[model samples]
Target: MEFLGIWIAAFLTLCIYSFLYRDNPFYRFAEHLLVGMSVGYIIILTIYFGLIPYAWDPIQKAVTGEASRWGFLTLIPICIGLLFFTRLSTRHAWLIRYPIAILMGVTSGIMIPNALQTDIFAQVQGTLNPFSVIGTLSSFEIFGAILIVIGVICTLTYFFFSVEHRGPIAGISKVGITFLMIGFGSAFGNTVMGRVALLIQRVDFLINDWIGTIF
Candidate 1:
């Protein structure tokens, strides 16, 4: 069974890789299979771990007097969730907007403060305290911290469009542009490296596990 599983995985891996040559039925089959399996797995998890445990079980417990009567309140959100299916019917599609608006309002309310705290305030705090390492850290560490401070300032300056881009502001913004390019290049390189790592793993599996098993 282990060998059978390995062989199946190897075949699917090759099927996906075959897309490098050209599109074909094998690649399509593998793609669809992966998507179908992923969706099926998510649905199962949602039913067992989410809906049954949180919604149905609570309602059952409430009925049996095993839990608080407030468990019936779960029906409100369940009905709201059911509203999402209204999108499939042209006449009742407008009802979906209510749930969507509620979702957006709640999500934004929850996320706005967290975003401000983590993204804006945290970044400002970090940038402001770059020199905090000066007394305790090595020169290289201090230089790195200074570099980070400079990068953050310049990057922020580049996005500032209030004043015209001339003279010192222009020069700093140009430095910001350079920093942006370097950041983007590093990100691209990292992504390429990740893909290369996956390729290496697949190739290693094909050569070692599949071929070695056959031999």
Candidate 2:
């Protein structure tokens, strides 16, 4: 059963990979199968994981009267969730804004503290190294760290339009762009290699399992 399942996965995987050639009935069938299976699984999981734990079990406990929970707060989230369906209605569409605004406000509030903590405070913390250090950790490491800090500052300056740039600022901006492009290029290369690794893994599975040998 395990081997059969493995081969079936490989065959469908090839069907998905056929998109590299061109789209056809096989790709369409595989795509539809993926979508259908994902939706069915999500629905089943919603009932098993979400509804059972949050809704059904609570209601069951409430019915037994041994549990003194009021279940009123649960109704609030349910009602807010239903407000999403208000998109279909022309009359009460304004009701959807309440939940949307609430979500946006909550998200913005959460993100502000997290962003400052992670991005700003973390960068400042990393830059607090003392000037003096020992043998192997020579002046080169300090120079490299200084270059990184300069890169970050100049890159941020390139985006600032509060003042005009001409001589030294323009030179710094050019350096910033060059540093940014090099960093971005390296990141993109790493991302491509990771994706290629995943492709190789899937292809290896197909060859070893489906073909019964790597040929």
Candidate 3:
């Protein structure tokens, strides 16, 4: 059984890698099989690990007086979850909006404060440290910090639509464009590097785990 699993995995890997040559039936079959299996696995996991344990069990306990009074509130989320299935029926599709709105509202309420704290406030704090720039520091470190401050100012200026881009604003906006391009290039390079790393890991697994087992 172990040997059979290895061969099956190797075959699927080959099927996926065949896409490098050109799109073909083998790649399509592998892609479809992967998606189908993923969906099936997710459904089973949701039922057993997620819904039953968290939702169903709590509701059962509440009904049997085994749970606290607050445990009955679990029925609210369960009813909201069932509302999602209304999306499948054209006439009752409007009912789906209740769950969707609840999900979005709760998510946004939770994420907005954290997003502001981490992405905006923390960034401003990091960028404008007077001690790092003005106090004792190496020339290179000070220069880098100064450059970052300038880049940030320029980038923000570029997005400031209230003032017309003329005279000094034009030059600053041009500088902002250069910084934007550099950031974009760096992000793209990081993405490519990540994909290459994943490819290497998969190849190593195939060579060491599967192929080495036989030969």
Output the number of the lDDT-best candidate: 1
lDDT of 3 by residue, 1-215 (tens): 98888889989999999999999999999999999999999999999999999898998898898988689898899999999999999999999999999999999999999999999999999998754557677878888888999999999988999989999999999899999999999999999999999899889979997888889
What TM value does model 3 have? 0.88
Candidate 1 per-residue lDDT over residues 1-215, each given as its tens digit: 98998899999999998999999999999999999999999999999999899889989999999999999998999899889999999999999998999999999999999999999999888876757656887889888888888898899999999999899999999999999999999999999999999889989999999998899
Cα deviation of 89, candidate 3, in Å: 1.1
- Global fold similarity of model 2 (TM-score): 0.83
Ten residues in a row with the worst lDDT in model 2?
A: 128-137
RMSD of each: 2.1, 3.0, 2.2
Candidate 2 on 1-215: residue-level lDDT in tens?
88778767877898888989999888899999999999999999999999778877766777787566685456666777679889889998889997898889989999999999999998776765533342446688877877877888889878877778788888888888988899999999999999999988887787777777434
Q: Lowest-scoring 10 consecutive residues by lDDT in candidate 3?
A: 128-137
TM-score result, candidate 1: 0.88
Model 1 misplacement above 4 A: 137-140, 161-168
